[model samples]
Target chain A: MPILQFVERDGILDLGWGHPRPGLLPVRQWQDATRAALDAYDWQALTYGHSAGPQPLVDWLAEHLGTVDALTASPGEFFVTAGASHALTLCATVLAAPGDVALVDVPTYHFALRILRDRGLRLVPVPRDDAGIDVEALGALVDRLRGDGQRIGLLYLVATFGNPTGLSVGEPRRTELVRFARAAGVTIVEDDTYRELGYEGAPPASLWSVDPGGPVVRAGSFSKTVAPGLRLGFVQAGPDVLDRLAGIGYVDSGGGLNHSVALAMATFARSGAYAEHVARVRAAYRSQRDALVDGLRAGVPGLDVPRPAGGWFLWLRLPEGMTAESLMVVAERNGVSFAGGAQFHTDPARGHDHIRLSFSLLSPAGLTDAADRLAAAIRSVAG
Target chain B: MPILQFVERDGILDLGWGHPRPGLLPVRQWQDATRAALDAYDWQALTYGHSAGPQPLVDWLAEHLGTVDALTASPGEFFVTAGASHALTLCATVLAAPGDVALVDVPTYHFALRILRDRGLRLVPVPRDDAGIDVEALGALVDRLRGDGQRIGLLYLVATFGNPTGLSVGEPRRTELVRFARAAGVTIVEDDTYRELGYEGAPPASLWSVDPGGPVVRAGSFSKTVAPGLRLGFVQAGPDVLDRLAGIGYVDSGGGLNHSVALAMATFARSGAYAEHVARVRAAYRSQRDALVDGLRAGVPGLDVPRPAGGWFLWLRLPEGMTAESLMVVAERNGVSFAGGAQFHTDPARGHDHIRLSFSLLSPAGLTDAADRLAAAIRSVAG
Candidate 1:
């Protein structure tokens, strides 16, 4: 029994952690902003801000997000959360009540599932393929659950590059999913956390962006694009839903937001350096994805490595004999770490053979080393 | 319809808002800390911190609270939350199952009620007198509810300076509450948001502090003492519960607490400024509380104003023939604002006669003005 046992086994290059890459953090600028804020704005800054988060950041995100006419925001329509996860938790709090079920993508972001579960939501997993969460399958799941006398409160989806599986919901499927949710009276919580990391052609319009007038809640964050550490993120919900979240948030933080973070984020977004910074981040992760996939193919044949279109993770399926648990032990022995797949699944029995490797946290060199170490560990364990 | 409607009709003396009183905020020192952290520690400072919140802040709180025994805190027992409300929301998420009930004190902190209700838990309100949440009544409610086959999963209370009521749970009742919770096998979420504002006898040892062995999940904050706008708070739970909360916390700001805040709080605590600052705040509130009560007696002869033992509020009962709604209108017209009782209650029918006023947010002069205005309004409406 170790004193620091909660950290579990360390030095496993935690691809499991979802923080913004440290290198991408605008440390100097943020420090400057914070210092200035503390000096001049500390009095008001130390009190609660508006529950919707800092107004300048909201104004910046609205201007920068480029959502279609289908999506417009007034100040009150935006709610600030602790992070993207906090946003989802708030959404879960307001949208899903007890005994209500939230429709989720199978093999979805684990945090979303955890949030829903924590809120006492009966999670109905909508099956997904490589093309992203199946729109038709979603319709079927909603109907099946409804038929079973269950009320589907919301359909949780990641419209841009999703976590665990880095696949975006295609445009046609997005439209179909919205249509299905509207007809089923299921609200959509479209998590766009990884939207900025897209390596493909212009990303699909957000579900909220496409729905002319439907039940859709779009959540985005500075965690991925700017810095997750700043703990600044926003959700644009329909007025009714946003109002509910705002009421809850008012109780939560009394609108006390970190103005310096908001200011830094606003500055980061305006720095003309944002596009370049994002490109640098994506290129680094894109390269790591290519490296990790290539490493599996070349060094550890038989592991099924899915080449992600965008985002930091590469979801791997070990060869027939190996399990994520065994691989985790071997990887730790070799000083490389990845989230054991079993931990991510809502249904653990179905997720044992898979593991998620994040490429974004590691530098290209570190990622290459991690890949080689993980490859060897997997091979030794499997053999 | 107005794009945004506020609950502040009587207008908030605009007080009741908690955290460091605005005038007392250490703007200059915070500016220095912010600049130092940003310029020197920018790279690491801007990314996501541990999901539980910043490590240093957690460490500081663990030491400062000095309430819980050190034996209880292994590596995982302490965690940082976005705020106390964030901690409570996570507590509700982790502890309450949908269709499950959470027992709360009647005339409890309004926001706690909202947070519990938002999670779809039927708030089983147990009545309270000066000694804090009535333990005998709570036991009866549990027995009655249990007989009804309803499961109560959590017992939520504010031990020190109970919000709204401004009472502390004495040691005997504290022990009894713990005994009652253990008998019911329900976890207790003790919210000590105003512990530092103690103006009278020594602060009662927290139930969590004394009965470190029991299942009490404690939440504390820098907001009330240092600055609420900083949005800095922590939750101490059993390791299993804390881990679950940490996992869920990632979705929110990735538990990216304001490190600058953590540093400032740590600085404030270490510098011994906290106790001195709180002393001044206590004296101010005690004076204002006395003034408000005095004025109500002299000016509004028929009103019932309970002198709060601690914290910044005076819970007032409207005179016969006076409605909170109408009195609020008159109060606002006379240039004073107060939080109406309806916003804090789950049942509108029960709380309409109540109005909550905060003297903390105003100056002694402002308090006089507010009391005068409120007194005039009461006479105008009731006479």
Candidate 2:
């Protein structure tokens, strides 16, 4: 197997991982950007960088984030991280302590659950609807947990086009999310990683956008829009948060993590290549998503599949009396694989009947085939 | 202003930062390497990579490191990191807890001191002589600290070509250090970052090499030998240490940090470009070291300076009654700025009369000029 991805297997179709499709990886664009970045900065960009980030990229990120959030954003509010995952790890390192409670959306990005657990954090799941997190339920959980003597350190939210559920908190709910953080004495880490890929226009204003300096730290990533291998992202945060991040051992010692790559990103962003690239990727993923959703609905009888507004995943609430585990075993027999819902939940007892399918890593035709295979598996499991 | 470095001032010379010289940043080599990497891997390198690292680079590093350490090494024992500083941070996160006692070399890399301190590790300076750390004394101190109910976490050692003071722990002492760690039940993080940059024939066998799969974790970096901005390095350790690192939140979530950069590094190393690059840098630094030392000895009467075997710095022992603080004041007036020794000590009271000057960031002529300026400062300060 290749280090970055699994090689082609005999018959299995992998719709399991959230990794971007291999076909869409832009080699030419990166080559051009690398060439241009070196030409522009020369060797000056190769030394120990400013801890915040490359200035060109930092300033550009500020402006780019402003457009994405539909608000005025400044350079001071951004801290460059390796990725959303890195941002999460860093914040967990500096802001939260071991055994602190991290409230996450049920059926959240499953990998995030493991990441937080490895940090020694206790994960608690909050209820979610199609429009995203239920603020009232989250508030109640916080109250209940605090009353039980558990310290709720943060609520990790994928507010704009979240991972598995492909859900967004409505504008009012975003405001509530921030307000709840303040009232409950918690931080709301809004992962705006997929904000740019919203096919149904923009999903909603960011939690950070709703309250700029409030207890919300928004994570932005080029992984979805650009390339995951770049391993570059930024956190849109308040000054206090940035200071805490900057003062951590890693950032303080090494400056920014990927300085050379950021320089390329700076030139890429400055020259308008990033925007164009995101648009191209967005259009491609939209088609792939539609193809899969349409096939799932038509091919699978009585399957209640919600059409995601944006992002890569489609959440299939399993057919009556059918479980994700049984479907997964049958799916494997039928040459299709998917992430089962139990993987995403903090509480294992929940999410027995849900399946998350990624629409980003295969062609529309490939996904249509995957949909057919999945339909067969579901039918066999239901029988 | 550039985010990665300081722009040239009108008249000042900076021997302060240990950043690689801008002139030798090897922009073309990186550009070539990037192109080759993309072509070789296609889109395979553009996704979430192996948590250990890219396999090609990992394997190549294992072989290359064997050559450097003068012992056999294997791929399974290597864990790629962002850089040396990152290795320190990661180990600190896993191997120790806040308030754990960290035994450090006195007058070590000042930035590392800050990095460890920020991680909330309590640093206790272990006295050093020219031959490197006194294992007998360190054992006694460890016994004393444990006797006092302090949990001694790890000893941070730059075993070869250590920063601020270009020193290496001798071969027999390296063995003794590992035994000490075993007896004391502690980890020894040997920062082998500058090992490959030896201007001399070679430094001693690595601490890890002396006792592979023992209590040592050796950190290697492309920063000194290639480009710091690449933020690429690795750790050679036993299975237990690699597992601890790979299981960390950041690595688990993000796969590996700087995957794209590592891909480029893989091609660079495999093609023999890395060996060529290291040789060139070593030769350049050797001349720069000689030029500065000779200039200082001739220009400044009775100034005691030790010729560094390898790496970037020269430790200048101040003349009788002349302190580093007083010399720094005069040096600044003469348009030379070098790092003061007090910054490197864990305790504030030590290192009052020693100075550390980097020979990496300037040309031979520039370093010679800097030496002359420092000599003038020394005379003025002595008077």
Candidate 3:
């Protein structure tokens, strides 16, 4: 058994991790894809590849985004990365210098915030409502930072099926965000890692699609849709941005981030196995989401559980006066665990009353059971 | 055919790239390894893995380094990276902030220079003789920089079979360099990527191994020994350094740089296939190196070609009045290509009389033909 399996075997009913459940991973398809990739390519498959990645993969991605996601990006705009985090790191490297300020959603993807901060960008969290990042608030923040002589270099947003919050910015808000970024002269980085894994219908039009050739940079990943193990993702930006990213010393020296694996994923994409796997995963996640929501509503009283249009999470605002910290203690005692909302907050105190539950890694039945346990925990905490 | 095969199919004899020859790549073995990795491991293989990379791979690497490379390092000292360049980048990110000084060899690996410079480090080139980087010069340079109030953050060296120059530091120099780093309070980053590729025998002791627990960071890669496309490498540093690297938000958020690939490589290592493959490659490289060296000696009179103890390169100093640039023009016209020594120089003008030839990617016959063509081009340029 792998170490993770051994560690996770204690049956804690984990709802904190957002990894796709095991049943959703298409192991057999990947086996075929790996075999086919090896058989199809020569030693070039194992040699230093193009810094932008395999051309076939790049071309396939362009077509897939255009036809499937309705995001029309040319091959020149795309550069393969190790994953979404890697792509974000590349963006941070190019768009912002150390000490520059990046405006992010208040309760953003925790890791996304970490990635940006790690690159030495000062993250200024902009508040968000049910619709997503409040565009007006972002504009005000950008103006305030600029007035203070702070260089607002980047605007990072998980615009579609956002992590932790499960919020998708409406199409109009995406356009507004892009407009605000353009006016502020800041590059808008849209992390669309969960875009393809929407449990409902497709998420809103990507910020890149809404404002093509604008300052919007879209980062897409196969991690959520296909398999995280592949560590394959791509960034779509304007020609100038693409050139800048491609010229980074890391890519220049190492060639593309991940070569053979990218080709294998390309094989998977070209063979249409990728789309098939995504569809299966989407259906599984949709059911898992429904089960969790239904169980939560049925078991918990006076809980505010917003129905996520799409994405992996169900954001729960606990009953008034009940802190997530206090409830989490009760929940753990009752054999359930979840990501504390405080972990996602830029200001930890702001998220004390909420919790983020990820249904992606649990079965429908598992999620239902988790919901019951969490409800009991909440009641115990409230009492 | 993959794009690389098409690009390389042209009749130009490329003596510049240092990739393993196609025949030397263990394609069948990797296929088996991939299958075995997936079969032996559970769903954890496809999930976000431990931030420090799979523990098994880390343990295996520790054992391999101790037994095979004669370098003793605990697992805590190792942090897996995407590749040697990635390892170097991480070292740059942590050891030196931007504007810090990194002392490097004058005519070093061009890409190494680029990776450091890309991280915004001020690279100070210290002179090097045939025995690799001059320890005395490095110490003097450090003293000067410190006196100037400039922080000397890192001393980067490819100690074993140095790239482009193919010069390995003697054991005594390794100790001297480590001691100097300790005295100067500067971190010594010993890039030992080519250590295992020694044709005749094992290379000199790694700087880290020479002075364990000293201020030495050793970077190793399977790129040369196994395959570059795998994008796998490791840095063996003190526990503190490893912890800092592992704590980098990029690694933490991404759950390790490349998990599945690392696991796959671990499977390859544990299976004994890696040892067999390395031995086979070493023998092939030895023959190719001899062929290139013999052909060059026989074809070109008064040429200064140092027989490398191991590694991929044959560094050549042309006869008087023959610049590498002028020879390269004639060589390309005659269907041969080499890395002009100027490309490796900190100041391009200094390497006008030098050139680097790599035999790792060519068959013995190919190397012989390339050498003959190169000789003809040299004669043409000399005239």
Candidate 4:
């Protein structure tokens, strides 16, 4: 009756989606955090919490995450959410409306696209370069759209380690883009969900840091670092902007985020375990990313594998004649699974030759085997 | 700026809202649950769970909650959400659309009204009697609205302890309402957030249990029974309907509900401690409710307070010549805070003479103090 149930019965590797790997989940850590929260807070932990977040966690996150990037906000600016996805959805609700146009990257995070669509907004897809969303093109597009009599609603960009592509928009683009958006009377929703697992050097200044007039809203999550199951994320924006989002949240969940998750995140942030935990994650994923790239390159000579800088994926352009759907069938038959390219595309059918492989879920040994199987599947399909 | 920060700084007691008192949260139980979850499961908990929910929580809730009302659901039929509010929002998204008319009772929850407005739906506010939403009037309204060429959207109702009203629609009306909805080809979003806080005898038969094939989606929350801070709730609907909502959830939050929250809810459900805990909550709220009613009735003799059947609220209809807003100022000056009833209505000005007092946050002593303060405020305002 509903669309959610229909296609779900068919099993997919789910690499098409972004969720924390089981191995990366700090189960004991989260439990310890939650238990500590419960024991310390009593029934109060279960009742309700501050609309922004529980104080300790927000304070700790503000302090700890500051060392990772330039944060324009103190703890007071952060509002916790059910997850990053929920945070984005709230942003969509507060910022976008029917007939309004939001500038989004082409082949963007599908969920973000869905958020805009669900909010009844017109999504203007801006072309992106390898470094990240192409600023020149974005400027031109905004100008062209305006020239064509369109009113740009807002600008949404994932600056660091974006989903599906794992490409970070460079420092120059982040600054210039925010500036352009400010000039164009657009607010920027900067999503930094994957900024923490930095296999690369330090991240550039955040958009929030550069914009002082309250045009930038930054949302960060603990999902990629300590554990995704915790489902804790926070949005930092101008107080006035945040208040509107909070009003929507007050309506949405009475509160958007769970207090226990906040407590656990606080514990993790306070203990400074997130840093060490995320470091280990980066190393583990680095090995996996390398292995995946090497395996694809060696096993499938014609494939083009873009080695992700920090995240857990290797986006591969399949060999000529090999469709992701066909390869998926072959892989499934061979007892190995990875996401088909189509799942990531706004238009699923057009990206049949692309595949997303996650080293995050596979062991070193499993990676070798999976790569071999995947290569065989591709070869069979291509041949 | 993030939305909540401004609201937090405004120094508003925010009693106009439904955020549970943080002091009542069940932190220890959640911590224990999370800790156990950590030791027992790994990536399974971290990665994407089933769209409906973690199987254990769903199964446990199905068994435990079934005693309250029979639920005809397979695993695929249940969908977890951030909270009851999220469930209702999804119902609005999937079932109602722009140009559609959602039939609501007058003096309904304001946020639901906002959601309907946000979705561009026409709201048909049917008048209500003290007994609850007038079923006969609802049927006529449905016919009248449908006759006027409006597509009847979903029937959004809160049956077990309604918000603001603190009234439960009687059983006969509940059954008749379901049948009426079925005949009209309309779906019903049954919110039971306060079901566990019943101060009276057996509650009405939930639409989900009474009419299996009718378009009824049952939403239940752990916020009232256990703690609001966990932000755990679920929707029980037909498999197909649940699936469609889940599909939107995939875009909303990779997964709808937080895994840790789900785990906490599961532990709370399976521990056999839930019933006792809920009974304790009910007993505590019932005492507070009685105190609130007594105070309002005696302290402000001319005020009309329909004895609430359950829930933590006492809605007071001010004596003639007094307005809720003006009285609220006096109450605050006297150090007692309550939400002016106007805030709960789509048209706040129309409810200027009504007030909503939450009894859950006040202890026996506090309730007395509040009552005295309220009495003085009403006297001053009336004079």
Q: Which candidate achieves the best TM-score against the true structure?
A: 3
Q: In terms of DockQ, which candidate is strongest?
A: 2
Q: What is the lDDT of candidate 3?
A: 0.83
Q: Give the TM-score of candidate 4.
A: 0.90
The DockQ figures for the candidates are 0.36, 0.65, 0.53, 0.42
Tens-digit lDDT string for candidate 4 (B1-383): 23122143233333344544444545555566665665555556665555667777877766666567655355556778777877777778888877898877667666677777666778777667766778787878778887888898787778777877788787677787788778878888888788777778766667777786467888888777777767778888886677678678333455536665686566666776677777777777777777767876788777676778888777778888788777777777777777777756655458887888777775655576677778888888888
* Chain A TM per candidate, in order of listing: 0.88, 0.96, 0.96, 0.88
Give the range of the ten consecutive residues with the poorest summed lDDT in model 2 chain A: A1-10
The sequence of per-residue lDDT tens digits that candidate 2 reaches over residues B293-361 is 998998886767788898888887899888888877788889999888888888898788888899999
Clash number by candidate, in order: 24, 1, 0, 25
Could you tell me every candidate's TM-score relative to the true structure? 0.85, 0.96, 0.96, 0.90
For model 1 the local lDDT of residue A2 reads 16
- Candidate 3's DockQ is 0.53
Local accuracy of candidate 4 as per-residue lDDT tens digits, A103-191: 87655566777777777788776787766677778878888988998877777777776666777778677787778777777788888
lDDT accuracy of residue A351 in candidate 2: 82
Comparison by TM-score, 2 against 3, better one: 3
How high is the lDDT of residue A173 in model 4?
75
> Each candidate's iRMS in angstroms?
5.3, 1.9, 3.0, 5.2
Query: Least accurate stretch of 10 residues (summed lDDT) in model 1 chain B?
Result: B1-10
How many Å off is the CA of A155 in candidate 3?
Answer: 0.3
Candidate 2 C-alpha RMSD relative to the actual structure: 2.1
lDDT of 3 at A111: 84
The Cα local distance difference test for each model comes to 0.69, 0.83, 0.83, 0.70
